[model samples]
Target chain A: MTTTTTRTSTAGAASTRRTRSSDTPFVTFEQANRRLKWALLAPALGFVGLMIAFPLVFTINLSLTDAFGAVNAGNSYVGLQNFADALTDTRRFWPAVGRTVTFTLGAVVLETVLGLALAMLMRKAFRGMEIVRTILMVPLLATPVAIGILWMLILDPTNGIANHLLGFVGIPPQEFLGSVSQSLPTLMLIDVWQWTPMMTVLLLAGLTTLPEEPEEAARVDGANAWQRFVHIILPMLRTTILTALVLRGVDALKTFDLIYATKGPGGGSDFEAETLNVYAYGLTFDYQEYGLASAVLVLFTLFIVAIVVVLRRRTERSAS
Target chain B: MTHVLRPRAARGIELSRRSFGVLAATSVLAACAGSPRTASPDAPLRVLAINHVWTQAISRYLPELEERIGRRVSLRMLTADQLTSSFNVKLNASATDIDVMTIRPLQDQMMFARNGWIADLTDRVEGDADYRWTDFQDAPRERSITAGAAVSVPVVTERPALYYRKDLLEEFGGAPRTLDDMLDIALETQRRSEGFFGFVGRGQRAGAVTQWSSFLYSFGGDFTVDGRSGIGTPEAVAAYEFYGRLLHDAGPPGATNMSLEQAMPIFAQGKAAMYVDADAIYSNFLDTSISTVTDTVGFAPFPAGQAGSVPHNIPSWSLAVNEFSLLRDDSWEFLRWASSPEMVARLQSEGIPGARQSVWDDPATLASFPADLAEAMRINAANGVGHDRPEVMQVGRARDIVGRPLVSGIVGEDVASVAADADAEFNDFLVRDNRQQEF
Candidate 1:
């Protein structure tokens, strides 16, 4: 009915416009409508162009130059020497790449598994559910830097609550973030603690959206709870799981604040916890190697894009 | 209804277009009409500084500065790293908002001067007689000059001092005067105390370099000798190994990760027998809230090595005018007032050390400090080197390379081989750094 009314009104408007004199100053109504649509969209398009496109293009251009120290300082174009330098750099670049991958994979995998399990357990409403939900949101609410500091205090080797608790259990004190070997793993745990709740919330929403009929039908067919979940609920939740993976994966790859706050520049003495994001930041701000930093950023951007594209493809496939 | 809606929709579009044009015009007008100049007649003299004791002590007397200059003063303080980041982002774009900046002459003066981010203060500092530019100590005063121009004026100077437990050291015949005695006392103290450490200092790769420089110098070595890498020298290797052995055997379990923020607490809490760090942080040992060994803490000159005690007497912080600032004259006025003889003496009496030699010379100012600490500071200052870290354009990267062997020592690795490797790396970095400077 709405479509019919809109069609009739448009026809009436066209007929009314046709009755006007051909020598009128205004163009046809269709042409004016088209121009008006573009004029309205121009500002938003301009903003996107300025904010996103310009910086990305500028960074790519910078990657090809020998920009150093101040941004406005005189610098000559050095072609792809910066990229070649980064690619060949085993000391910092490769180690940072390895760390970024290790951190993202370890943190995301744990978050997804734990989040899915928690979401399943909490799917049904029970006593004091709201309070439990609120408690789960605490980690998500705190700033990353604040969380990093809190974790550092808790995990301090000599005089921390974590060591105190371990001592009660007859375990020796473990250097969590302090030891170079343990820094990355400790950061992964912190990431898991802070972000698992977000994953649970997302998966819970997905769980709520799942149809109950299929599960009921499987239960009625002599399937157990685990069987019904595996046969029915899991298959249906594939798209949501993949969506959550993409969202969380992208975020995990770009983690900086917590790592920087806890481990500091070059990600501790040995650059043990220095991921790609932190490395790029150190190069750009700390060392003022803008040209080299830009090259690393461009490469990092492409790496993230490639991962996102692969994940998105899987999501679409699961949805189909 | 559709015919009526079409004209209204078109009119809405037309209104939006008109509004956009008006908004665009207003934005252009706003862009052209800049904010009131910070240097203007009645505007505040804006200062960006690090959140240090010097900045804190000076902040209380800002009203005096304002009264003298006949203008309001706006001082904003940030952590050292935060201040550096702010300067890099702001000065890169030639920001005029910051009139005066507290800078690290040794760490960032070269870069800032090279980039022309800081104004040349040679004329203002030298031409004014009462300001007494030469009154500043030789080591710190020499550091203020970048490329033959006085780019910054030293405000706070630092040197390494031995912080020992007075109570613990009495059993070992007081503070050790030599490196060997210090190590022996540290080892004996560690052997007696179950959970306590013998010696604690910075061990982090980059953060440890400045403190380690004193040891390097006393060991008859330097970061560079005649513009070449010096870390592979026998003296340098011995220095690195001795530092590593000191920490690895008698220091805490995670000494490799401890910088000032981590290591200072151990000494303050009476968990370590001997600690060496900047003299600027002596108050941390005396602060009731943070220190448990206030009464027991003792200060001594940096322990003598093969070449005797040669600590780093360097300008830790300084004040400079932003090159792009419109209030350069007013900024100069603030600098001169802050660094003047009377002001430095006043601040020094309150326990904030100043760069002026006259302040150090005054017995009245020395009265505020514990007698031993004052003596230590005096001796260290007289015998200190100008620069602590590697003197290069990329100081951060250079420190990292120079400090790799230090970390190796702390982690109980072979120091000689690591020093050789790091020495090679540092030489390569210096060559590249020199090339960049030429650019």
Candidate 2:
């Protein structure tokens, strides 16, 4: 028994000595814990910073220079000239900004409202609900370029299913993609068709997690569905709604694939559907004006961030 | 404790080292085994080709090319625009990968020559007695020089042609010989038919610039004269008006937004009576499977305007050696062989339009293609201008500037004012290009 006790004491003493040798007493357990926490997170934090900050810094640098196409071996620095040029050019940049805003707002607003309605409808259980859910996922899961081509064929003025259906109603063919005036709205509708499902899925998830007590109590108190939804359900879904808004709005702002696939380059022939993203791509690759393209991208980023900020503030106020 | 931990940690590290060594060795062996490239790095002649029809034809004769050059050749083919953009990036990096690349002689290739991006073949051509550099037809051979350097070899000279329906023309009247005559024929034809259009051409902004240039030149105007913007001239305005009036009043309803891709289908399917496009796309018209009116489709020179007919007689694509290439001698051998008279004749026999006097003038070539089409192509080739779009480093930007007004014209906006606005932009373009870039 004495030998056993002595061995336990010695082991404990060795462990204590190790602890003392590894770190000074000045660093308490809490301080060591804080250090361990930081050390654990260092790699992820560093990766995130490098991924986010590196491209941003490089883009800003390119924006400030007079970097042109591939031949810009030196890319002679002409500070802020590109920015000035892009800002003053009422012909291309300003018009592209207007288009970007219009496309984003139209797509996001419609998607959110439609998504909410869809989520509400989908909340109730029904036969083949899983199949319906899977069906809803199809558009979101489709390749964007394939979708664009499919829509192009379906909306073809002379030979398309859309026109064929219209003919049955004794209606004339509509110039959907061909007409410049109609192209933007048509593209917006396409965006809504594709992305509304994403919002529906997100809001559906939010709806599932909501507390049932308030809803039941409201039902017992003789409140109607609309009233309860407006006063309680909506209020509780603030974070979920914001999440959907930011995700959808940001994606809509950066919409390039569908538009590019539908229209060749520089938006359509007349630049009818050109957003700032498309314009920047044209500047960078088509025209080889890298410096000017970078400036446009920078300004576009600012515009997107400003929009998100404004949206967040409005949502916060409404939620409160 | 230190003594115990030391051996364990060392053993772990030693195991890791052995594993890493094995992995590295295995990877090295796999890479060597999997790589299909067998020729010595310096021996393989790297050729970059754009997927133009002419290049597609060239691809068919690669075995013959290898025999003629007496070297192993590796060809990299990319789509037209992708090749162009990638070529610029590759050249900027001074990469020695591509020994030869397909280029345009006058349009954008001159800019490469000015920047010393391509090798000058002047000495090589002048020294070779059998190469016969002068036999590539005067117009195409002359365009081969850029900044006084012979940078490229001609392959195919593409000229715009008016494709018309013989049956439709016979019913309406004889083929229209002039612009005004065409207008009358188109209007009458349109009025008489239910699903037929009088005329159709490209109307997209950028690509339209090339087709639109034929109109501008026929109306006795040009994009520039001695480095001055000529878009505001009365002749240019007249051209725009006539072009716009034809598409809006006589052509199909949606012709305003059509490119050659869309316009050709309507013509081939017998929806439109006529189409004006590059002779390079002749296959699209001649293919029995694609063209319903192939039997009735007849080729003609562009109808005369006030200045008579002028079409783009430029080489749509060319092959040039990269200046930075280590295999310049090998690339030269490929160019010399592929552009040789016998090789060209072989291709011409297969219906590839070779950019040479001998090829177009050969009896076999004329018989191989349509005889009437050959005659017209030969005449247009002899007379067409060297550059359709502005021959400058900033050609794309300049095209966009001049092209916007063309869009406005198609869409029924006041094109005169649009041209005025574009002219101002064009003038600015000239200054910017001169101030900043070289070619």
Candidate 3:
């Protein structure tokens, strides 16, 4: 009984103190409070500095030197030569960049549009929403290499079920991944099928946490569902959309396992699926051109960072 | 108000501080825990072998190996590509994960030996009274060892030769003995057959390059003369042009992307009249599970080029021990048992080819194999066509240089331009790779 009474009195006293302090302007405890806040944030700031910042600096430094294979013998300090070579080297580098951009853009756009539609459809309760959601997560969690192999078997021109099914509809057979022109697009479809669920889940979370008053108010002001969603809901979800785009863009740029699993070194006979990440890996492991691969990786990292920064800036502006 | 805020901030700080303090304390304590890979000074030595049918053959004799050496033996199976980079990486980084491994003799030897990744097994071979390098044919032994230095023992001998459908040959004016005859036969047969290709070989850069190199070598077009680019000659161009035409007319629809394994099915399904590939495919074709037309198979030497059937000797697989391996003696004991004449006979009876020379002469072994298959092996072994040399170490670059562009051209995309461009690129690679240093 005594402890309860003391706790109530202490809470009352704190509230009273707060009320009194709000009446005063320019409190003198600001400096101490600011110092304490900074001290609390130091660990996370330091962790990011060490793990992310340090390695990036190290990679940049390594990129400047010519180091091949495990042996550091015959290494020459060739500043900016790696960058120049990466830009001009036609056998493996520039083609890789082109592939990277195509893959990222294709995957991001398709996944976003599909994910948005799915999220909207599943917004309300359904008979087996949980089961459907669980089924969607299977592809996301499954290994990319295993998925590549499964797709390879499914897309085999001779005995695949895909062509068999197409035949039933009186459609001529198509060379899916085997065709030079079709491989990248086929991979994009695969990327969308595997990852759209992740985007859907993220958007759904954003939707649930959304304040209802603004949407309800719009509905009352002679607005249809589409009008309210376009004018209010979409604008409100800009930050979440931006987050999804950035995440997907970064991953799609570094897609290695799927391409490697499907096409061996040099990204198939014609190099139809040779993206930047796969190119760098092939250079390092297959060719033992470590210096060249390291240089390519550094350029690729900068390109990804630039993309992320642009997306983040747009996200921040919209959020504000 | 300041006092109230102070309590909340202090609570936050206390919670963080307590968690961080606990983590720091526990990590410091945990640092003194027991280790994972403590060495047993008195423990019996362990041996690891590279994987394949070769490993399967070696595994059979491990009991004999353990009995002889009085130590434990362990074998691992890794694909050809896995064993290559892993062996190199493990040698550089850990120095322990691998003790013994299999490597392709030519490409792996120079890098491995120059980096001191492999020990000089010359001493071991010389010291062992029973060890006989002379027992093997001189050319293969020369290809396996480096500058008279035996670093590893050869496991399996493979050579690339021509394989054809006997039935198809009978239908298409009989077997081709010359390059012109082969081309003529292919052209004539493809005109008559509805869906069947006259000749199906690798048209993919790396795959086709191996097949192309044999023709080039046979036509007296060397890749390097005293370690310089000799691939720019008329003979080389003729060889490249011949294959390009072959791809254009008589090869399969997707022949430009096909490897030997990929082309095998087409031939096995009776869609392809002929294929030129490694001897390992011999078993694959004979296997009842996969092959459809195994009974109609005919093997022959690679048809005569301008210089007459100079078979291109492609090195298959060999086993090498790591420099820092503790079980050097035990590893050799296993290799000896694995490569013995009796064991070779046993493996040969089961349809596995052996690296030993004595197995080649055995009547029983020859009796078990098809007459054509035996004849092809004997000719390849006799000719020294598919041998590995120091110059072949640049095969990776060569595939891109001589191979990739050739493939792009053969696909009818941009034939001459791609070839010229590849020539320029390969020239630069050759100069940069210090390819001239091989001499």
Residue-level lDDT of model 1, residues B224-252, one tens digit each, is 98888999999999999999999988988
Give the TM-score of chain A, superposed on the true chain A, for all candidates in the order listed. Answer: 0.91, 0.83, 0.82
Q: Candidate 3 — which residues are off by over 4 angstroms?
A: A1-61, A72-76, A167-173, A212-225, B1-50, B127-129, B184-196, B388-394, B414-417, B435-439
> DockQ for the candidate 1 complex?
0.36
Highest DockQ scorer: 1
Candidate 3 per-residue C-alpha lDDT over A1-320 given as tens digits, one digit per residue, 9 for 90 to 100: 01111224657666554653575222224334554555667678767866899777766776788766453445677898888989998856778788889998999899998898899888889999999999988999999999988887687554457877988998766667666778889998988888899999988888887899999999889899999989988988888999888888898888999887766667777788899888887776666666677889998988988998999998888888
Classify candidate 3 by CAPRI docking class.
incorrect
Which 10 residues in a row give candidate 2 chain B its minimum summed lDDT? B1-10
Please write out the lDDT profile of model 3 over residues B1-439, one tens digit for every residue: 3323333324443333456657556755775454345445444444444556767866776777677766666667776667776775677653654556677776676566655677677776667667666676555566666656788777677777678878878865556888888888787767422456778787766656766777777777766656556556666667777777676688765455566656777777777677777766777777778887788878888788898877655546666777767656656666566666777778777666766778777868777668888788778667755453225444565675677555765666655566666666666666766742342
User: Distance (Å) between predicted and true CA of A247, model 3?
Assistant: 1.3
- Kindly list the per-residue Cα lDDT of model 2 for residues B1-439, writing each as its tens digit: 1211222323322222345557556755774463233335447789999877667777777887787667778888897667877777788767778889988775567567755678999998878989888888776787888767788888877888888889889865656778888878777777422546788888777878888888888889999877888998999988888888777766765554567767788788887777888887877778989889879888888778999888778877888998888878878988898898988888877777877786776788667677667776876776688778876677777878888877777777898998998898898888877775554
List TM-scores for all candidates, in order.
0.93, 0.86, 0.83
Local distance difference test, candidate 1: 0.89
Candidates sorted by DockQ, best first: 1, 2, 3
Query: Model 3 RMSD to the real structure?
Result: 7.9
